[model samples]
Target: MMSEEKSALTQTERTFGRRQIQAGHALMMLISRAIPHPIGEVWAAVTDPDRLEQYVGRPEGDLRRGGTYELPDGTRGDILRCDPPRMLTLSVQRPGGHSAELELHLTAEDSRTRIDLKYASVRKGFVLIDAASGEWAAGPGWEFFLDSLSDFLNGENPEEPLGIIGWRTFEGEQLGLYQARNAEWEKVKADWDHEHEATPGPS
Candidate 1:
């Protein structure tokens, strides 16, 4: 299933990137979501290494300016910048050494806090269309993350994965492409339903 999803996403990405085949630019935007936790609590959740692992990806070692972190699979990267309870910029060591800056801005409203995450992917040249389409394709991941983070911060787990599935198969015929995408969506939705059933309910 994973292989199939990956293949579909690759094809969709190729179609999405055809225009930017030469030089694809980076993506930048601010995404905001409300967390049930208080501002101070949310602040700690992002700054504290132990707390961060529960919501975001796990941390490798101490989290501070100039510190390094690794993904669960041991993909390592450095903490380019760290601002207490607020902003964080990391240099991800990927195939092309892509740099990503994650900033968490906290603001208090009523009894809850609004966390604004600005994700900036730094690449060369112009890639707005590709970036926008990729974002639309990857919407499920962000949606899952927001939902899971809300549960985690409120002292619970949704018991679900945070990711997306994009399907695409083009046969040089527009109608064929549409039908293929529709079929793929059905398969993806069914798979997601199965995964959700296997997962335990919220606490």
Candidate 2:
């Protein structure tokens, strides 16, 4: 089990991510982390169904490109692209007929594997309350999952289902970690907005 201080440090380090506006009203969120594992091991941990169930929910259905899959929690999505040991993209459907895109790209950084995740969603008046809060929700959500992935890679067994709020640590509930990460995302969005304001063009 990881100490509370160590877990907090891990969350802080993974909190750094970026938010950007894509074509028109679409928004893109990106987060990347380098795990101290080789590409093959990291790739397998993310793509293998049995391994995935350890941290993320167990996936059901064909995982290959163009196949549809459902998670144990009933979240369904279609695999848009799947390139072994490199990239995986999916179109995840949300409530109210809206959908989001998630893309994962992996690369070998020396002996470690760097995972880059991009999540994009089209802005619907009600779907996303606002850019800042929407990013606050999505950004830390991925950080929580990636942190779970790190825990799994380090041989720590997960005790409960993964989620953004009320995440558990060795000590107990660590909602503070989630809140801190949310703060980071808010800052990222603010910084991006400031930079765009200064430059005056689409970002």
Candidate 3:
């Protein structure tokens, strides 16, 4: 009887694990920072196309249900639903027959606002065969996208490809930042090399 119970537990765990992966590797994090502005101000920062372009990917949809969004290089998607200043649901359909759902939620806090972002991939293995796959992170794209969004909200440009391939290619300001960052890394590498030379290895 005990052995049977163990088997049942294992099966339950496996089921949960599979469900999580199907949800595109679940991740939840909270970021709290003073926006130095009101909730509506931050809301406008995200929903207004002209304002958003300053800090995020250019959007080309009406931002309503049954609307569409054109990403950089002409990649596009339809808006599944949206509730202004509160939530948005998007259906990002890729060329490789993979689609995903992006859920964005915003909540107002006194003098500040909190944004919750969630991404669920409706189609699995889309990255392995899609051209636009490079536009997102290998493991999950939500983190990278949110990081960029935060930086933009703070009035800063993203560091690289602006997405998944940011680390793969360097351009203009990206190249400059890359070079600077690598130069600092090289210094650390040299120090490590010197330390290694002074230490003894396994015999």
Candidate 4:
């Protein structure tokens, strides 16, 4: 699991073992994080379109069950479930792929909140994302947004990213973060994912 920091964890308890998936079983991702914010604040940060746009993307939808949502980068989904300041589920479809079932769970404390995110798909190959960031290739994407949420809670609204791929791409281009991130990704996949390539998983 990714802790408070956006950086990766060396070892994470996983639900899927290292193995190649054919056409039957889907790859899955599960992660949990604790944020130092109230449940209401945390919920708004993730579900509120405007606030969500501050990190993920601009969303246009009623945000109710069965409502459709399209993120800024063309990623689309249906709101499968929405529970105030607590839980949410989405049928997310990436830019050029089939839909995946996504779930989010939250619990609140007096001054903090915990979130568990899950994503699963049988039709989509999570290779790219997995190659990009091992666990988050299909994740709640806290690494990309946790800091943004922190910024929002602190009232320092950011002007870039929020859900715009171009903005993040520009930053990676400008700061060379992509090269570093990809380099590390390559190493991680080689050390970890490579073993699963030829080993067929449950079909």
Off by over 4 Å in 2: 1-25, 95-98, 124-136, 163-173, 197-203
Clashes of 4: 6
Clashes of each: 0, 0, 1, 6
- Per residue, candidate 4 scores C-alpha lDDT tens digits across 1-203 of 55422243322222333212222356655556677888888888788777776666778876777789887777787887887878898877776666567777889866988776666677544523444433334332433455467678778876666565432344433224333434444455465556666777799
Kindly list the per-residue Cα lDDT of model 3 for residues 38-139, writing each as its tens digit.
Answer: 667766776777766665556786666777887654456778777787777676565555556566677887876766555555454321213454443322
After best superposition, candidate 4 residue 202: deviation in angstroms? 18
Candidate 2, residues 1-203, lDDT tens digits: the string is: 99774565453332222333322345677787788989999889888988988777788998788898887655678998899999998887654455677888999989988898887777443121244434326777777778888889899967765732232332235556666666667777777667656555687
Between prediction 2 and prediction 3, the one with superior TM-score is: 2
- Tell me which residue pairs clash in candidate 1: none
| Candidate 4 local Cα displacement, residue 25, angstroms | 4.2
TM-score winner: 2
Residue-level lDDT tens digits of model 1 in 1-203: 56644443333211111111112444444446666677777777666656656655566765668887776534456776776655666654433354544455678887787766554454532112133433322222333345456767778843322222222322354324334444444455455446646667799
Report the C-alpha displacement of residue 168, candidate 4, in angstroms: 7.3
Give residue 58's error in model 3 in angstroms. 1.7
Model 4: CA > 4 A from native: 1-25, 123-136, 139-142, 166-203
Could you tell me the lDDT of residue 192 within candidate 2?
64
Alpha-carbon lDDT, every model: 0.49, 0.69, 0.50, 0.60
